[model samples]
Target: MPIERLADLANPATTPRIVFKVGSALLFGAGGVPDREWLASLVAEIAAAHARGQQVIIVSSGAIALGSARLGFAKGGRGSLADAQASAAVGQIALAGLWSDLLATHGIVAAQLLLTLEDLEDRRRYLNASATLGRLLQAGAVPVINENDSVATQEIRFGDNDRLAARVAQAASAQAVVLLSDVDGLYDRHPSEPGASLLEQVKGVTADVHAMASGTSGSGMGSGGMTSKLQAAEIATRAGITLAIANGTHASPLARALGEEIGTLFTPVRRDGARKAWLGGRLRMKGLLVVDDGCARALARGGSLLASGIVEVEGDFRRGDPVIVRDQAGGQLAQGLSEYDAAEIDRIRGARSNQQEELLGYAPRSAVIHRDQLVLL
Candidate 1:
């Protein structure tokens, strides 16, 4: 959908699309309940952005905490898996209701989506979710996403919303992401430690940056910390998306941070295309496809990896699996989505397109890794 207008209220650098991530600590105000007044201010900011034709998506935490409060127990409850799930189950309702009501105050609808880590890992499911978020924005609804803790097993959960927010930014093709937590931004060390200083702008998330990270939040309601925010920066930067770590405890967090640049901003590294960003952002690789020097040259020229150029297919990868492209010297060159399974690629490796169908006894698809599916490393 086309943006109808643009204004200063929207984030100047990334106005068209942005994701705002609110952590539980900020959502859980005094007395273990949502600070309705604070939330109302944030919602008003969102409404203003919507009016400016800046699409906004929210990744919010606090369901489990809300649920725990409703269960009339400590947020941890018994600290068991069942207890956690029960809290999330009850809290999701209240949390969703709160968001709906707050957003509805401005005639905006809040569309809730609960996603597990597995959903973003699978291509089919990821595409489905990406499309759904797009449609929601076109329909003028703000997408309020949260990790699917209610039914997700520990193995399939995100554990923290920081990285989840980055994944949602990638999925939504957001131009920027703002992580709203208790602290204003990332510090050189634990914020309370003597001499600790806030880093205003991070060019990249390096080892030194990781060294600066602190542990999980001291606030009992939160799971993410500076370490996870750095991890999130790594994910978002690769996708060419700008990310900010900002304080959300007060009202109008977006206006304060985005307008005043009052946060730690991580800039984008590449801006070629969203598809390439997705490939660059992907963390999983099913296998490696080693190519001849000729194939490597072709890939550099923006050509696909035809079977004829493949010298080796390593791993038991299935069709459409993500794989790294390597040169003859074992130097990583690119990563792409493989069109053929490992067994099939092995059979057809070094074979020209004409010979592919003859050897496999079936008509073959195009490139082993199409150019559109590949990104230079």
Candidate 2:
């Protein structure tokens, strides 16, 4: 199908569960105050989506900008980590208040979710977050997610909400993710540069696609530029979610981005099952389990990783953590959520299924990493 057809918001088929990544630059006006008129228009677009039975999730930025204004910090005066933290602490209140009030006027309840990178990395926390967001959606509430900047140290920060938005879409299994930007779409060169051209459709985010983005970050009000949006596009599309980078300056930006060909559209590959998406999309592994040739062949044939097959357990990880499955030759073949903790797996290494009960006093599962939870690399 032509990628442009998916941009039509009027086509219900193009949208089911949609995630909108709102930029700080678009949320705040001069002096870092809330741009109420602009926000109202965005809310109207969201309300229209609701009317059509489409669920919306907003991964918004601007807490730091709003908080800095409230704390009397001069524009661009976010000097230290502490200063940014203070600003986020103050700005989150204003950001939530604005969203709550605007969404309320349209009869939509706003639910706030403050997350850290750890929330998505830990398997247990990942499930908790998914359940919470799912319930909020089921109850007809719009989830307004943001990184917990108030407590996030420089090392822990998502850096920009663009990537966070993609992770959120993946976690929620959203069908589409829209990144609202100052410009309409990706360009062959900086839009300000002579002879630049817009790209309306992208099948994948290749290195050439990334090269098209400007080196500079976005407006001072936001940290993410077209570069981060491309990173986000890569994450979303890989997880089978379509992504759009569109201009948010318009009166009904969401509606316009959806219904018109006013932005760059990224098409997703065929989606796998939930387990596959989670297993395949994880960027970090908590541990590694090396197995013999027999087990490697079993995994290649879509079989589980049995405890008896494991030769060595490397890394400190609790049960249910993501672990890489490697062969004795040191080649990675798959990854999955482990059914046993690292210590337990160490004790049960090279043990048969029946021997698990004898070694651990009880056997909860025969497979160290079940086939249902595994994804081949």
Candidate 3:
């Protein structure tokens, strides 16, 4: 779609599959409890979209903030991971209850979904989570998603929901993602600087904008800084999903963005189907296979990775695990689920199919990785 058309469709009123992300700063103040009036109004706008037949998914951040308030701790104490986890345990319930109660006022049901990065990295777990969210959307229930902070260690945490929201948009095949932050939009320079101008529409987030962005979060409580938001934009745009960064200070901010008058719009690079986008972008590879030059050419021309073409296998990956197929020069050519285990692949490397039984006493399938299971990078 053209940039102008994307702008037109992103207007909060017309978006079909809309994914809105709410940062912690917007949901709470110094006291840490939610601003009920502001949250209520935000729910009203989402309910309006639902009434208009638009499918909406909300990625919210505020569990830690709410948890701090409920636990009677200061917002900034340099707490350990255990402290943060404790807060999340207390705040998650309040967060979900608030959303459910507010949404119920408009006769819309809200369902809570907690996820960790691990869920998106594993193919089977990813599919199961996707199917559950899909069913909620199909049943007309608004799904509110958050990172599983309680159980997620620092290594596995999403850190911020901005990136998670982008991944979710790809998983849900959403048309656009709305990032509601404390600031209005992307500026040529820091908004606090003199003569800084707001960039209305960005064809692409260039390196210059990225350089200008400081690693500063507008709200002290949120983890996503301007740089992280830019990172999220890159991820969403590359997956062919439009992204809008706007101010969440006011109620009905999404409605304003939908009007195409209030946000920094990042246009899509290339649109991809839902499953393809998820498979190509979200699934984490478990292993790698190095191929010869001839096999590289065939793969570049849209061929599969056959046993005869493979030179070596690396990593202890099992069958059906996502693996990267690289050339001898270390250039990634494709990604796919492997049909053979690493040990089996090592034995069958460079061997023809007919010689498989003679060498190994058993032949798995002919192809090492089938074409249908592979995605050319």
Candidate 4:
């Protein structure tokens, strides 16, 4: 189907869930003051999305910038990590209050979720974060997510909200991710260059797509540029989520997105279940599990990988690492997250599910890899 048809402006139910990324450049006005007018318009859009039964999640940026301003720093004047982190600390409180108060005016509850890369990358934390966001949507509250700048070291940060928004979409199983920025969409060349035209649709992020990203300037307010947005598109599309880059500085950006009138859309065929999609993504597979024919057959029928799979485990991997499941002949069958680390799996190989605890000297977890976490490759 054409990407525009999915917009279904008259009835937003077609896109059940959307994650909008609001950058710092659009969040504040002159003198580091909050852009209440712009924010109010966005709050209205959120209310509209909810009334239409379209769940909304916001990955917003501005805490650090706001904090910087509150600290009496000039624009782009932060000279050290200490300065930036301190600014985020001061700004996050106001940011949360701003969202919560604005949303309250619409009778909507705003929930703040401050996260770092670790929150989404660790298995236990990932499950908790995803579940929390899902519950917020279910409870009719809008989740306002941002990078945990206060705690994140420079080397550990997402650096840009674009990728964070895409990851959040994956975590929450969102159907669409709209990156609202200073520019309308992707251009064939730098938009400033003559004949640099906006491309309406992108099938996938390719080498050519990366080339198009060069010289495309950002809002000069956010850390990300078109390059980061393209990275986001790759992440979102790989998980079967549609991503669009549009100019949020314009009036009613969501309306334009819903009307299919602006932005460069990147759409792909929907893939496996939410968790399965994560497993299928660009995770570095740490180990290979060789299962027997019976076990392989069971897996193909949507069954979880049992302890009795009688597999030969290759590689020393920790728990929660992605692993390739293979038949006895070493033919890859599927990919999944491993519940047990490699050593534990080796000890339990060929053992019954009930014997898992006996062999491991502890209560066993569920399947070696539960069906929900497995993706047939």
> Top model by TM-score, which number?
3
Count of residue pairs whose backbone atoms collide, per candidate:
0, 3, 2, 0
lDDT of 1 at 145: 93
- For model 2, residues 1-377, the per-residue Cα lDDT tens digits are 22344455444565668889898889878888788998999998888888788888999999999888888886643777888889999888888888999999989999999998888766678889999999999999999999989998867667889888988998887888888999998999999899988888898777788888974566777888888888888777767888888999888886677666778888875566766776666656889999999999999998989988899999999888889989987877888999989999998999887777888988548688989888876
For residues 1-377, write the lDDT of model 4, one tens digit per residue.
22454364225555787898998889888778888988899888888888878888989899988898888876542567887788889989999999999889988899999999878766678889999999999999999999988888876778888989988999998878889888888999888899989888898787799898953345566788999898888778878888888878866777775565677888864556666666665335778999999999998898999889855989999888888888877676788888999999999999987878889999988798998888875
Candidate 1 vs candidate 3, lDDT winner? 1
The digit string of per-residue lDDT tens for model 3 on 13-101 reads 54678899998888887778688888988998889888878889999999888887888876442277877888898889999998899
Once model 1 is optimally superposed onto the true structure by TM-score, how far is the C-alpha of residue 363 displaced, in angstroms?
Answer: 14
Clash count, candidate 3 = 2
Evaluate model 2: give its lDDT: 0.84
Question: Model 4 reaches what TM-score against the true structure?
Answer: 0.75
Q: What is the lDDT of candidate 4?
A: 0.82
Q: Any runs in candidate 3 off by more than 4 Å, and if so which?
A: 1-14, 73-78, 186-218, 288-300, 305-315, 324-334, 340-369
Which 10-residue window in model 1 sums to the lowest lDDT? Answer: 1-10
lDDT, model 1:
0.83
Tell me the deviation in Å of residue 9 in model 3.
4.5
lDDT of 4 at 376: 73
lDDT of each: 0.83, 0.84, 0.82, 0.82
Which segments of candidate 2 are over 4 A away from where they belong? 1-6, 74-77, 283-377
Candidate 1's C-alpha runs over 4 A off are: 1-9, 12-14, 73-78, 283-319, 323-377
